[model samples]
Target: MPKSKTKKRSGTDATENRPKRSRQSQGGTPVNSASQGGGDVEARESPLQGHKCLWIMGSSIVHWAERTARLDDPQLGFTKHNMSVKWKGCRGLVFDGLDKLMDSMLMEMPKPQFILIHCGSNDLTSEGVTGKMLIEKIQCSILRYQALFCKTTIIWSSILQRRYWHYAPLGAGKKIEKKRTRVNIAIKSFILKNGGQYIDNNNISAKEVNLFHTDGTHLSSLGNSILINNWKTALQSLINSTPDNSLLTLPTATL
Candidate 1:
């Protein structure tokens, strides 16, 4: 759960069973960005009530966070924000796999208010893949998702730099880095142009050493914390900037 309210643009009268601040978030803008752990002072206990939902989707980086930080735990960081937060990711998942994953999600959950995607790193490392090819595929997939979920917002997260390219040959780090940069720039451009938010992870690099694990593909604990903080900042800005949402607070109910 986030320390923010669900930005519900359209829906039937959802039972208002959240806190007072969440109810207020609907009429006015919210400005709380719980940078890092423990979130905001408004955070509440489990079983929050909300109409909109959030989904954080990706591969290793996301999966690692969920495994170590339980980032998806709906009760972990519920500040006045009234949306249920869920995490979906796994190790070695590629871009195409992401499409399948999201499609599968439709069968299990309602349309989400936001979906944060942080995948494509694995595909970047796979032999014979070029940035151009990957970018085209990603563009199609993202567009499909956007068209299907007309009301939902899409957040395109950039790929992180790796100390090592898993499937590439020795000393191919630089080549992979170049491709990754090109892919990120191109993707970022498309996302911004076509109505999507972008989160850049260039601040976290393999060069930092402290930010990465020995495996070089995953992030260290401290690294994940930083990544999450960045997300908080970006998402809070996006949430607060949106206009005209009405929220209500009824008795608390199980998620």
Candidate 2:
């Protein structure tokens, strides 16, 4: 994470701060938080108006991509639909750290109708973490979160295939890539089987020119754009998938 001064306090939302909210999405899931740039102010100023709220949460992948998504752009359809979007990104976030991430945000904003999670690439390179082990941990977390969050829809974003595996030995790249595929497949199957949704990001792989930075770990400008585009598309598709607008009514989270 690019260390910065603690962020200024973002004030109350326009919507009535409800007690625990039920979550739902077109396909399923939500987006979250503020971006690295001053997008936090932009999100705070928008009135949620009880419409669909999406919280996009993840690692720096999300932090770097919010400006490109521009969900807060008033001229965009997202604004017209009266949906609220929040992006919560952290540079060094890992898979198991998601619980802590959400816990930290609980009191900051209203519950979102969907939570679109795009993380886990870092865990693949972490010491002693195996693909199967990560998947099992993820399953436990998902079920526990579903129980605690109640109706909150959880959407899994597939980790994009990386050309370089940061922190691993030079020869470990191919092995890590294979693990990435297995992790994605296993998690996707689990999420779908459990009535959740998945965002497939295989298109933004290393094969694409300039999609990744020279480090091959993070995304380049064009790559972030593609990533956000896929997210926006998923948000729209999921929002419109089910006609159960009644499910959009949310309760506040218990602090």
**Against the hidden true structure, what lDDT does model 2 obtain?**
0.64
For candidate 2, the 10 contiguous residues with the lowest summed lDDT are 34-43
List candidate 1 stretches off by more than 4 Å. 1-50, 71-79, 244-255
Q: How many clashes does the backbone of model 2 have?
A: 24
Q: Encode model 2's per-residue lDDT on 133-241: one tens digit a residue.
A: 9999788777765554544567788887665565676566667778989998898778766656677765565655466665556777677756666666666666665
> Mind giving the per-residue lDDT tens digits that candidate 1 earns over 1-255?
112234432111111222222110111112211111111112112233355577889897887776655645532353456666788977789998987788777757677777889999888767677889999988888788776666566787788877656557656667777888999899877776666777776556565666666555678776676677556656665666635322212111111
| Per-model TM-score on C-alpha atoms | 0.73, 0.73
User: What is the C-alpha local distance difference test score of each model?
Assistant: 0.64, 0.64
